[model samples]
Target: MTTTATAGADAVVVGAGHNGLVAANLLADAGWDILVLEATQAPGGAVRSAEVTAPGYLSDLYSSFYPLGYASPVLRGLDLDRYGLTWTHAPDVLAHLLPDGRAAVVNRDVDTTAASLEAFAPGDGDRWRHAYADWREVAEPMLDTITTPFPPVRGGLTLLRRLRVSGALRLARRLVVPVRKLGDELFDGDGGPALLAGCALHTDLSPEEAGSGVYGWLLAMLGQQVGWPVPVGGSQKITDALVARLVARGGRIDYGARVDRVLTARGRAMGVRTVGGATWRARRAVLADIPAPALFLDLVGAAALPPRLVEDLAHFKWDGSTLKVDWALSAPVPWKNRAVAAAGTVHLGADLDGLTTYSAALARGEVPRDPFLLVGQMSVADPSHSPPGTESLWSYTHLPFRRHWRAEEIAGHVERMEEVLEEAAPGFRSLIVGRHVAGPADLEQGDPSLVGGAVGGGTAAAYQQLFLRPIPGLGRADTPVDRLFLASSSAHPGGGVHGAPGANAARAALARDRALTGELYAGVIGAAHRAVYR
Candidate 1:
């Protein structure tokens, strides 16, 4: 049915990203009449993947691999496997190629990884295992606790309670420390820190950036244990699977509908206004899966925003922009190391200085002459991606967030990117039969959620985490408006393909009806200030 003039649903979701879809599923599961308003022609925001270059070639427009996919219990509970979503794993040899023609093949077995570490620095591998074991104690619960919605006081306490009284104290100290310190404290040489820093860079957090240490080691270890794999078909499979489940439950999705404003009255969120002038009203709640700044500043209107919320918005720090290059290859990326060639996701930074210089230059508003690039040989990782014996590769580097990009600049950048790839693999540029470049503007045109093309919503830096995320004083998911809530990567636990933010928002909305169920979540976020920041 077409939405009537006075039409209303139990819940209204703005943006059809995976988080919004996850939230919509939870509402529909509870028998709520739900309406999902999408700005794009289809669902799946950053999680979207498409065939950008060739007939058989597929490109991940945004997010591709998922270590977060495996860690998200909320996603696990959704029983995605029953929905036809399957995951593949690469071998333990997750490789990091250096300019010296040497590479680190991280294996799943701790002993094997230990041996790899040992090669770089004697006894360093053993230290890595020791550090990993310590992380193991908190990894599960920390992943659970941090991803909790606004009121995770009990969840926070639960995590705190679970911490080894002694270990917790140590972790508490480490939590605020930078990744450089954490890596340096644990490793005897630069290899562990270099490789680990590369992983955290995946989220746009520089190694020098505080709070990134957690993400760096966390994902690195997770990838070692579970090789970063794409869904069987491509990243689109994950989004399609989620949308299929939502539609199966009678959910309504309006595509090609770009939202321009969030309608509110009496300090409460009521609905949204699209660029087409269509209005959607929700009696229960509004879940926004876009950036918080885009919500309060662009969509929600600055005047309607609470004063503190406005101040909080000012303090928000968006990470740098990104430059993505996709290729249709005639064959696989013939990595110098045979083992790394077989690995699913390869980190290709020549050395520590190369990584630092690239990131530092991005900070200084100049593209690094030799940018640190994350090279994904998609077809080689999964054979079904391209024509027989052909492959599709994705490599990206961070660029300063400013100005529109030109076609010539992007072309030159692609050429430079191929040169970088060829450093690890001898004849990489020759195989490119097709290619596409997405600059900041292209990303903006593609998905508005990538504000200034900062793909992870915003940087996943420690300062912008949990309580301080998006802005300080409002970390509980709930915005200044009564029923409006943020359900995007801008929220707690930051960015990942994980549906935690969406799940967290749905549970929060459900709390208004259930009351006590989500109180623990609210409490945790509330406690951060009650305990420390205040």
Candidate 2:
């Protein structure tokens, strides 16, 4: 049953991305009158897919690969494959180009990856294997903890049981361990840190950052287990399928509607106001898939929010840096390191010293002399992202988002980016037919959710994670504003294309209801939040 009156709508969602769509779908299925307002003409903000350059070339607008989505039990429960979502995985998980004309490849076959590590450093194989095993033991449970709206109690206990006795004593220390130190401690040879460091750097994390080492190693294990698979038609298919299901379930999406504020009465959020002067009241709740800063500073307004919230908001650390350059190529990238060509994704940097230099420069708000680049070959992974016989390459290196681009700043950064590619893929630039560059500003234009070009919404650093995310002591999905909640990457389990934040938000809203809708949302959310938090 749908809402007989537009004014009787039970909830309003500010964005129609995967997370927003997931939240909307849950509400609609429960017989709530729901209206999802999307600022973009299209749905799926970062997950949007289109033929950006040429015909038959469907490029994912922003996010590309998603292991998080695959591992997610929340999105999986939706059975999106039936609605038009297919995944294609390469045999090799990834590869990183070393300064010394060699490459390290992480393969889905554990023995193969271990053997590769053994080739570089003999005893490292056993160590790597042990790490993978450890991850498999706690992977799903750990994911459940961060994603659920409530604190993950049982998941934490189960995970603690899996931890090595000694490992338990130093959980906090382990989280704070630098990536370099963690790699060096676990794997004794060159291949160890090189492979793990590259993985750690995947999400704008510096090797020296506390908790990054753990983040890197775990994702690498996940890759070896699942191979960072790209969807057959780009990441957008995930969103489209979810949206299609939502509409089929009697949901409605209103595009080109930009929300400017969340309306509240007596400290309880009840509706949202669009910039165009339209106010839609929510009978139950409102979900904002926007970043916390925008939600608090602009939408909610600092005056309305608590002082601690405003201060906490100011202290939020954003992993600053991203320079995306999408290229239309004549042929596939030819690599000097053969392994680089075979691997779906590549990480580029000269050495530990080189990466350290860039990290320091970035911290100081100055563009790095040499930026570490992450390159993705869209056509190689999924031809749908490019025309036939032609290729589309996605490459970007991090640089401090500061003023004073000085004449050669952008030019030098671009030169270094191309040079990094050329070093691994020797004939890369020569095959380029067209190019488009996106700095932080361009990314902001694409979606306000990607604040300051931080695609993860905010830094995925250890300090800002878990219950402390967005702010400390408020990870229950419910804001101080009562029915208002965050339903985007900015919320916990933090980042990636998975729909946990949206699911968590919807479950919280449905908790206020007790009918069939409440029962369904409760079960799905219960399977998560309770399995973890309670």
Candidate 3:
């Protein structure tokens, strides 16, 4: 490893993931001299792409879709397009393959999507339209509440004004309902319910779990509003654009620099020491864009944290592990149902019942015999993903957290996934020119933040969500230690590439420095917390 003399920066950010880069960019934009240190040689964390399967095929190693990234309020202001970022979308956002040779397709147009569902059950089309109309009424406020700081006073007020007592109460009830229950209540057909249930599986939540309805509803609505998009060229384009913007603003990133410890003095973070024995001092703040456990236990040390916080960390639950496979396809997936061909994403596991069973198996610490899958047809979404006339396909399935799989077991899982694909898209296996597999252990090896390969930061269960995420308290980005912040997906608004946690952390850091704007923002957030909780 390369070593350099100790240097000082106004703000030191550990990790070069999208969130870390976002924090650095925001601080640097405010004229703070920013320094970012990443343990890996490359940035983007899970949002990365490479020719993993074949030289000509670009495969997203982790995250493929970017509905949240596209809709992020923090990212929208960045004007990433100016830095060479382009988005590509498929004709349809997603499709759920049913057992009866039919598909529940989600189109960007609500009418078209509802029409697709209407085929299965009469009147379901109108029901779908009604649900979307309701979503549209509060979409702006809902997005604002989620993407903004915790408590979301302004967002809450906006929502309250738009939705009076009765409406707000109804919406809140809907959010808390289990996906299975919500689907059963709203739609009579398996098509509509299956689509919603499949969306719930995007997180670790089962269809029967409370609070999962929100996940399903949010993704399904977002698909209609913004259609799942991918960065043109490859996901690396997102990282490249972010890096370009940061560099243009006079920020610097030091790759292959692993932070060993956070240097603190008198209960205030002052700097950080790297594994290379080189120390970089921070004059203002130290922001860690790593998981909470790693930041508190490894870098800052559990001894530095309060005993209660340490104890709370011990009980923090991880979502679940994952098994991802990327394939360089000789041709597009030969779907048994042609309607699924135009979709960028496809969900497999027959119906809601299969999904419920899959989730139950995961809860029992056993791999489901019929695992649910989230498949991405990269070339359909972005032609740049593969060579001419070819395709790049990827699929991922959830696994029990911390479960160890032997080589044979891993192989069996892979075979089972292929069989599931075959069931949905005949001849899908024959089209695979090359393939790459990343088991839970492999994912953790690539990015330590994906602890136990549990993506989405941690469980978004009702008990662990919102204010209780990572730990119980107001979900502010600030930590107990002064001038220190947690800017990872482990923070509020949970996961996805939204960059809210990073932006929130930067705002908190700025507030500590007595910046007037930051102070006012923090004040509003605090007031909102009081109003909501009290």
Top candidate on lDDT is 3
Please count the clashing residue pairs in each candidate, in the order shown.
Answer: 13, 5, 0
Q: Pick the candidate with the highest TM-score.
A: 3
Prediction 3 TM-score vs. true: 0.96
Task: At residue 504, give the lDDT of candidate 2.
Answer: 86
What RMSD, rounded to one decimal, does every model reach?
Answer: 3.2, 4.8, 2.8
- In model 1, which runs have C-alpha deviations exceeding 4 angstroms? 1-6, 514-534
What is the model-wide C-alpha lDDT for candidate 2? 0.77
Q: What C-alpha lDDT values do all the predictions have?
A: 0.78, 0.77, 0.88
lDDT of 1 by residue, 203-299 (tens): 6766677777877777887776666767888888888889889989999898887888888998778888888567888888899998888888999
Q: Among all windows of ten consecutive residues in candidate 2, which has the lowest summed lDDT? A: 525-534
Arrange candidates, best TM-score first: 3, 1, 2
Candidate 2: give the clashing pairs.
Answer: 151-533, 152-532, 152-533, 153-532, 153-533
Superior candidate under lDDT, 1 versus 2: 1
lDDT of 2 by residue, 4-104 (tens): 22363688998987889989887877888788999888888788766665555566668887777887778888888989988997657788788887777
Q: Show model 3 residue runs off by greater than 4 Å.
A: 1-5, 515-534
